[model samples]
Structures are given as C-alpha cells and as structure tokens.
Target: MERIQEALAKARAQRQQGSATRTEHAAPPKINPSVDDAWGALSPFKLNRALLKSHRVVAAETGRDAAPYDLLRTKIIHQAQMNNWRRVAIVSPDMGAGKSTTVANLAFSFERQRDMRVLCIDLDLRRPSLHKVLGQKSDHSMSDVLNGHVRFSEHGLRLGERVAFGLNNGPAPNPSELLLSQAARDTLEGIEQDYAPNLTLFDISPLNASDDNIAFLQNVDCAIIIAAAETTPIKRIDQAERQVAELTNVMGIVLNKCRYISDNDGYDYY
Candidate 1:
C-alpha cells in the first residue's frame, strides 16, 4: 500500500510539473498598434480628391462618355468577374505607383457604383497606407487580430459606406508570416461566409519591396497588377505579371494613369 501511494504521488507530481511548464511557457502574443500614426497621415478630403482625379483620368482615357465617377463605377463591376474569387489582391511593381489610390477608389466604386457588399482589406503591413487613402481612423488592425490583440470585427472600419480592413504597424517581422497565418485564413473565410460579397479587395504591399503580397495570393482566387502610364517599364510589368502568376491565379493587368490620346483605351478591356 505504501508503494502504491508513492507511485500515485509520483504521477501527481509529474502532472503538476507538466501543468506548470505549460503555464510558464505560454505567453500572450504581442502586437503593435499604430493607430495614431495611421490616422495622423490623412485629412478627410485627401482620399476623396485622389479618387475623383483617378476616376476622371480613367473616364477620359477610356472615352466612357459618362461622368468620371460613373466610369469608375463601371470599371469595378468589370473587376468582380473572377470565378469563386471573392478576394482580389491589388498590387504594383513599386512604391509611388498609385496602387493604394487605385485600391481605395476601386473599393469605393464597388460599393457605391454596384451596390455590392465589399470588404477592402489593407494587407500592406509594411508601410501600410490604406488608412490615409480611405480617410479612416483605425484603432486596431490586422496585426492585432493575428496576434490575438483584437478580433477581426474590432479592426474593421466603414468608410464612405464601404468596409475597410486595416492592420497596425509593429516591429517588422517577416510580413509574410502574418499574411499566411491561420488567423488570416480563418478571417478571410469568415468574410466569405458573412458577407458573401460580389468582391473583396485586398490592397497588398508592393511586390518588389516585400513578399507579403505573395502569402495571400494563393489563398485569393485572383490578382490585379497595376501599371502606371509612361512610367512603368515593360520589364517591371512583366516581372509583376510573372510574380503574380507564380503565386496566385492571375486575372489580368489594369493600366492606370494612361493618357487619353488613344481610341483603344476602353475597347481594350478583355
């Protein structure tokens, strides 16, 4: 009986030690909340103005014959044609390439122009600038959700009657890690289930600067590569196309900031 008690005591001790070890090893995940930095970067009217300008450029170049804003609406409807792909990643070759502006306007156009349910996720963890483009004050972001600092619903903001997803900036770990995390996948799945939108746009980081964009590409059904007019070299566009093709289901390219001199602008859309 004494030997039996000793064996049971030893087993209890082992269990206690295991519990202690687990408790000691487990720590709450850390996150960086760059809310002030994100909100401080914008004025309310700045994004609206940019959207208006881009819309005008597209309208004039395409010979849409409608108001620029109306033309923008038409373009967004065209973007949602990807099969089983509610999420679309918008990317560019490099910075100052007008991707953020294009994505914000595209999201806006999706909601206002088509009356479709849309969620615009700003997955550009490195140098995230979507908040400024959307004129939203994001208290929590994608980073927060990934690390358990917040929930996905908590980080979402509604701007101009459309949904915008933002992520907080923190110590720059490999941004791809977060994008490929299970949390991101589940969050996207929830988005697909809850809204079941005609389109969901993910404004990802520039491909040349970071690989974060690639992490979400395979998960999303398609990608849209943006090229600026007169500036984006052919090689750069090719590289963007190749990169997206390698990682994602490539939809096609959208030539932004193109001149209105050509008659083939609108008709070229396939």
Candidate 2:
C-alpha cells in the first residue's frame, strides 16, 4: 500500500513539474504511448511470429483460427459499445481450459484493428503465464506494481502500436490479498488513466479453483468464461456462470480446444 501511495505521489509530482516548467524544458522528450520506446529500454521484446504460430496464436496469417478470433473481436466490440465496457476478465472453470491462450490470441487479434488500444495484464498470481505466452519475459510484473516495487510505465511491456502487456512470473504468498487490496484497485485505475486503453484484458485464475477471480472481477468491467470442449463438466460451468454473474457481467463463454469436423458440407465446428 505504501508503494502505491508513493507511486501516486510521484505521478502527481511529475504532472505538477511538467505544468510548471512548460516552455522552458520542452517536456523532457515524452514517452510516446503510440510506439515501442526503444530497443531494450522501455519496450518489451517483439513476439516471435514462428513461436506464436506453434502456440496456436490466432493471427491474420492463421486461416482457420482467424475467423473465430475475428468474430470474437466483433462480438466483444459490440458488447463493449453496448454496455460501455472498457475492461474484461478472461477466466476459466478450471486450469488447462485455454484461458491464457484465449487472452493472448485476443490481444494479438486486437492489435490488427486500427485505432484500438488493448492492455493485457496477467493477474493470475498463482501462475502468471503471460510473460511466457507473449514471449516478453520480464523480471517485474503487476505483482511488483501493486506491491509498489515499480510503476506501471516503468514495468509495462509495449508489444505493438496498440497493444501493451503487464505480465507476472512469480507467485505471491497471498494472491487474493494482492488482487483484493485497495492498492490493487488504485494501481489498475492509475494504469487506466495513464494508458487509456480501449480494452483492458485481465487474465485471471480459474473461478472454481479459488476466490481470486471473483474478488478480482470486482475491479474490472466484465468476465468471459472459458470451457474446454469435453473436459469441462456441465455442473462446473453452471456453477462458474452463476458465481461470475453475481460479481460482474458474464460477457460470454469461449469454447476453446473445440474440434472441427469437415465433410462435403465443408467445415462444421462441433
């Protein structure tokens, strides 16, 4: 909490200093929010296209998977516009439901859209995977930011022009406390104000596995439940749906790892 307070104060002081100095200093070369800062300074490493393809990251080059991500993007945009939502939590009923992969693909897909800003944060404190998924390994992440180890700007990884990611790698002893703390909420709000991303994707832990998703969803706009094709049981899905609905808007369910069958009628998703 003290770290968050100091960050807030530092931000305020910087703003005040900027206003006072004005024409004399010429704003000390502002950090361009539009593009990657430099090589290895503030910008994150560029995602390897080949590695991403192997991981089944949905991109424009991906023939079959692109359509689903495109449709998902459309639906997400429509819902966001309809409900005036800017933040969404991507969660699953249990582990191995492809929640992290879904978030990675969605963020990558959003990058292709013109004028769309997306900030993808790995809030799965128990097992932070975005760093590895995005190929942007970082020593610091949202855990550090929330704990006041670093500020958002200093720790954020800018991938493309429109996409920025805050990733975590280490597990905190008290994961729920980090997400539910006032400092966590304020840190998110600060990042929102600084970056002003159109869509903020919070990749959270499984809803049934722990109370992290429910508690964290209280700080976001909506949630999308991810269910594996055959592994996820109906009762677990129903339970997760009901529980999430009570906390935030159940945006929609993503059926990941679904098989596709092709016949004379072309392709049919089962």
**206, model 1: CA deviation in Å?**
1.0
Q: Estimate each model's TM-score.
A: 0.67, 0.81
Q: Score candidate 1 by lDDT.
A: 0.59
CA shift at 194, candidate 2, in angstroms?
0.5
Which prediction has the highest lDDT against the true structure?
2
Q: Write the per-residue lDDT of candidate 2 for residues 131-228, one digit (tens) a residue.
A: 77666667676889988879878888776677788888677668877877778877886676566667788999987666676557655567899999
The per-prediction tally of clashing pairs is 1, 0
Q: lDDT per residue, candidate 1, 39-118, as tens digits?
A: 22322222454554444323212234333435644654565442434557888988777777777556545545434556
**lDDT scores for all predictions?**
0.59, 0.73
